[model samples]
Target chain A: MTRAVTIIGLLLTVIIGAGTYWVSHEVERLEKRYAGIQSEILAEQESIHVLQAEWSYLNNPERIERLSQEYLSLAQIDTLQMASIDDLPENADQHLYRLDKFGEAVAFLPVPRTRPGDLMPDEAAEAMIIDAPSVANAGGNQ
Target chain B: MSFMRFSYWLRGDRPELRPEQRERLAIETARNRIFITGAMFFVGFTWISYGLLDASVLRQGNEPAVASGTDTRELKTERADIVDRNGILLATDLPTNSLYADARVVKDPVESADLLLTALPDLDRDTLIRHLSSRKAFVWLRRNLTPEQQYQVNSLGIPGLNFQREERRVYPHGRLFAHTLGFTDIDNNGIAGVEREFDNELRINNGPLQLSLDTRVQYALEEEVQKAMETYSAAGAAGLVMDVYTGEVIGMTSLPDFDPHRPGQAPADARFNRTTLGVYEMGSVFKLFNTAIALETGSANLNSVFDATEPLRIARFSIRDYHAENRWLTVPEILVHSSNIGSARMAMAFGGETQQKYLKKLGMLEKPEIELPEVGGPLLPHPWREINTMTISYGHGIAVTPLQVVNGISTIVNGGIRRPSTIVKQDGAPAGERVFSRKTSDLMRRLMRLVVTDGSGKKAEVAGYFLGGKTGTSEKLVNGRYVKNARMSTFVAAFPMQDPKYVVLVTLDEPKGTKETYGFATAGWVSAPAVGKVVTRIAPLLGIEPANAKAPEIEQALQIELRKGERKLASF
Candidate 1:
């Protein structure tokens, strides 16, 4: 009888001790999971913040305006140069409207040539004499 | 003897081979066994119930955490960023930290307050100590601290000091778009402009906010107008550069403007947006529309001439120009001279009702409906009469906001399409409704070209750029008196009249003429030259190359042939 009583007391002690251990183990596991989740949340918050700043930096107005101005030349229209269909130049090869207003056209000037033998020709000398008065006048001739 | 035996067994130290002893022993053993079994059952039941209760409690507490673990669980989401047309940042939200305190756990309130105040001098130490020593569990110290402030505060490392996550709205461009973009309140609530209009959607959505404002164009326009204001010594000036075709407001400036960051520091006048709000009687500039109305309504044609031999005498008013040419001027010459007499004659021919219809059709004589909150309604003559028509023909008896004038002129030049102005850049934009016939638009464009070519708008002409515009100067009404010294000078212009692209308008209020200007404060003297300068600066930037080559065809079509007597007078 003494031995049986002793066995029951031993069983009670072991079961209670094991139950307490299980509860404590579960509580510790939950604590670790909570801390992990909290850290993850904090990291994500930081990432969002960084993204917002970068987004704004990418869309800086002043920088974009300066770049477009340098490259596109987004300028005000010059009203004086506004010409109609009837205003096309006579000597132009094409009659198309030119939006380019900054002297983009290639221009050619015609120069009359004089004969090289005119130095020896008598008739040419007389004609040159008429123009030579201007040259003489450059030397302060009366 | 048996009972005696039982009692003996119950308390027995020794007893052997007795039937009573055996029976007593059996009964005592059974009773002990029953008590042990019952106690074991009760203990097991109590422990089982306790375990179930604890599990349920944990499940209730953990349900919210698990349910919130799905997609709904978000630490923080990005806010919409505000950007200009060229992808420049105007406004953005940055992640910030706020300092809080667990007042109950604060070991030394006096020390904590002193340390916090040292980092943030704006904080009052006495107030901080009072708050920290309160019985409340929690108290806020400071919110939306900068990174440096956060680092400094964290280094203090006081017990019970905590940090809460927050966001701070930052405008890196500062005062550039103060009035237009507007600033948000302390709680990040948009109080004005596009921010206020679309606050709800932005709060819910996470993306970048786009605006139609081209910062480059804005800078040029603002700089030019501000310079004009300075050069002319004007009280204030407003300027706008808009794409005639798309009606996109490329740039707009209203000085003196305030900064969005520190709005409280700016004066009320500095906060006023003159371009969109301030309405003024824009004198002869309205003649452009009056003549167009007479021609469009079939009341008169380009060949129709007004009898301007004398100033028309009304009941209490007489209509005349600053320097009226008493001779009968042709329709084109009337516009060239900016003759108020000729304009009044044209308005009389069209009459009052017809004039109102045309003015309304031109988007004048009404309030300017823009996206901004600061829009001004037109100040129209209460008793609409024939006199009003005559006066309004030369821009009197009527007042309109500058924005309306620019938009109205854009309609006339942009193939007569009345495109409501927009500050938004859509990917695939649609065409605006046609306001005037293609014929009228073309003719009006020719007339406008003629204005700049040979008329009062000559000062507004930029070489190689077909700049067409009109000049207007109205006597400012101050304290119920017409102040001659104070006048509002305005110049409205458009370029490449053959194919209109942009419309740039400038206006100066109460401008004081300088010695260089010969003490003349008219639009032709002040605003016209400013328009010319702006065109010169912005044209090269917009890729419109200046061609000095003669446009013989346009010159022929737009050239003026003087009358026989005028030609004879030229020889004199």
Candidate 2:
């Protein structure tokens, strides 16, 4: 019994030592990762500071105004062009154009359209009727 | 075993015993050994735990060492940034590398100097060679170099050359915000302007210091003033835009301005801040105060007439009208026509003491309270006599900074509340001292509007924005005498006269007459038109909608009733 108790104590010490060694090694690895992340954050912050300064320099009013004058045909807003909401048309439906309906009406017009294959049956019929005259003109020329 | 046997023999305690007794003695010895070992382990663990606790919790309050290295003591004290109200960066610190040389380490001074000179052509070659050749341990060659330049110098791979990281105070907007932000010295010390005024706060605080200035408004004001200076061939020009209700200076410009990056190269006159530092006899704009005070003190009313058939003679100094209306003029007419004789009569009616009280209440008796280190105190008349009062009423004897004039007018037009002018943004509408009654302020606003509509300030009238202002054309005092042709024309204006929001003041020193102005170099011809252009440009930016000119409420607010035969005289 004395020998067994001595053996168990020795085994417990060995297990505890192994566990402590593993925990310390894991801690060191995590600490290295944490240091790397901290350095990355510092590097990112420095770049952000540099970028902010460059952004402000590029967006300076004097430079923007000169660029606008050289490249863009924009002018200063005149007071006469500004109108309050009260001056808008009373009938909102009449003023606002429905893009879908307008698209159907001008389906045969020689303009580029998105998703040309998604036309409804009625729109297809209208487009054919509008294109008939142009098609006949092509046939007569041939 | 020998020592134990000797101790037993010395005590003379040898006795024959049974096996059980021997075992009991062995157990006692073993128990004592285990107890001693446990005690030693406990003490060692407790001491270590105490040390860990002391290191973490007890010493936590100690400050981290800020002085990292001997060479970086001045550069490491990080300063707070300065930004406009809209968060556009005006001033900030940029970390840059400054080149230094260790003369002892330099192998070949001639080749190093040649290579360095090629990279930095601006540096004097002889000076650099001297610095590199000297036996000094360390010598500074250049400061605040660009990253590209530092890389180019580093690529040379010279042994003696080294770089020390330094902080440079950079003004990103350069001359655009020169006078307002001021500039720092080479050591990053605040030398002038708001930078000097709030140096302590900037050094201690880690957050950005926000100013009340709007860059958009500042650029517009500066552009207009620059155009005016060039068109009129004036010596210098100053312009200010202030929020009347809060006394916040939105934009202030004084030209010719210098770039803050190299303030040493600029002339002393360019560095002078005219808006706050230069005091001028701001001519007829002071008449707004005269009229407001007369109406406020019940000394004169809108309909009260002042005899202006001849110039008013007060002692040896006489006050004459610039545009003489040789007749009895009413209160509104005096301001509309900018009649100095009529303003003098009004001042006399109120007496000199009353005028002093009014001017003092308007914050014109002292230096303007603004967030700038270079503020000029008002040059007040020494004796405080009758002649001084009459001339001061028409803005001759008393001289004040342009900022004071703008603030004083802001007080009158912003419903008589006097708020100290500020360049820092406030939390909300600041509480102000009531200088004039609301009724008096309203009446003053109406009279100012009348000046724009049918008076000498007609040149300042915009189509949609209701602008009311006063014109002052005073001959600049040169060598104790007024120079007749060297006139300082000033125009002070408040926009949307029905309920004023902003007060703009434009002043031109010695503006020459152009053919477009028909040889008239007066405030009405020069400064008034500039004020009109500034108000038109800034109003839309401030989100102030243009109201109809025929709007009934505005018409009712600005309508003036004419007396019998007064309509004929109004045609002037």
Best candidate according to DockQ: 1
Docking class of 1: incorrect
- Chain B TM-score, one value per candidate, order as shown: 0.79, 0.88
Candidate 2 has a TM-score of 0.84
lDDT of 1 by residue, A42-83 (tens): 787768656656665554555666687899957544444344
RMSD of each: 14.2, 14.1
Write down the DockQ of candidate 2: 0.07
Tens digit per residue, CA lDDT, model 2, B1-572: 88888885554434355667766766776787789999999999999989988888888778375524333212223677888888988888778899999999998888899988888989998898888899788999998899999999999898899999888888777888899999898888898998899999888856789999988899889999899989999999999999998899999999999999999999999999999999999988999999999999999988888788888886787778866888888888888778899888899899999998878988899989999999999989999988888888889999999999999999888889999999999887798999999999999888898888667787787767789988888889888888987988899999889889999999998998776676678898899999999988899988787777666787787777544114345544
lDDT of 1: 0.76
Candidate 1 lDDT, tens digit per residue, B1-572? 88888886676323674778777877777888789999999999999998898788756766555545443344433446677777777777767799889999999999988888778889888889998999578789888887788888889888888999877777766666776777777778888776776687668756667877776667777778888899888989899888887777777888888778677788989878788888888998898888778777777777666767678899998988776788777777788888899899889987999888767876787777667777788889878988898999999878898888888889888777787777776564346777677777777788888777667776776766678888888988776567867899999998866667888999999887765565667898789988888888777667674543244554543444433112234323
Q: Alpha carbon lDDT of residue B327, candidate 2?
A: 85
How many Å off is the CA of A74 in candidate 2?
0.9
Quote the lDDT for B138 in model 2.
93
Provide DockQ values for all models, in the order shown. Answer: 0.10, 0.07
